[model samples]
Target: MNDSFTLGFGGGGFEAALRNWEPIISQTISFVPTLEGGLKGGMNQREIDRGVDGFKQLIESYFSNVALSENRFTRAVRFK
Candidate 1:
């Protein structure tokens, strides 16, 4: 699991890497509940849904920052 998370974080460059992080995190979170009673005996639907929603917010914030950084870089290059 750690390896998978690390790979997802460093796999693709920039945009691609950010995109990959979403699913990897989601899958990892979803799997946690299954360790007790197989595939269908863990966390409730509400908990899973909340986890997914939280992930979406985190991804959005990351992408927003990436976009802002890219815009600043572009502006700097243009001014130079």
Candidate 2:
């Protein structure tokens, strides 16, 4: 479980790094679970923040100079 989370964070961070490599990418990062999970139609404030936090921490912790985004990178149209 821990390994997976670490790998997941690293993978998402890599994506974030790619996204910020050029201006063509959007400022808002398309995050993973926490983001997609929080964005569901009925989620409350805490629920939303929890999801955003997962990806946000990855960017903020390692890429402090980059833009901070509250969004997630989901391949599906509806994450929920």
Rate residue 60 of model 2 by lDDT. Answer: 60
* Candidate 2: C-alpha lDDT: 0.49
> Which pairs of residues collide in candidate 2?
30-72, 30-73, 31-72, 31-73, 34-51
| lDDT of each residue in 12-63, candidate 2, tens digit only | 4655645534441344344454477776779878878887778768656644
Q: After superposition, how far is residue 75 of candidate 2 from its true place, in Å?
A: 31
Cα lDDT, model 2, residue 19: 56
Identify the runs in model 1 with alpha carbons over 4 angstroms from their true place: 1-41, 67-80
Tell me how far candidate 1 lies from the true structure as C-alpha RMSD in angstroms: 11.8
Residue 22 in candidate 2, Cα distance off native in Å: 2.3
lDDT string, candidate 1, 1-80, tens digits: 22443332333357755464454456445434434332243766765666656656655665476634554333322211
State the displacement of the C-alpha of residue 78, model 2, in Å, after optimal TM-score superposition.
34
Error of 2 at 28 (Å): 9.0
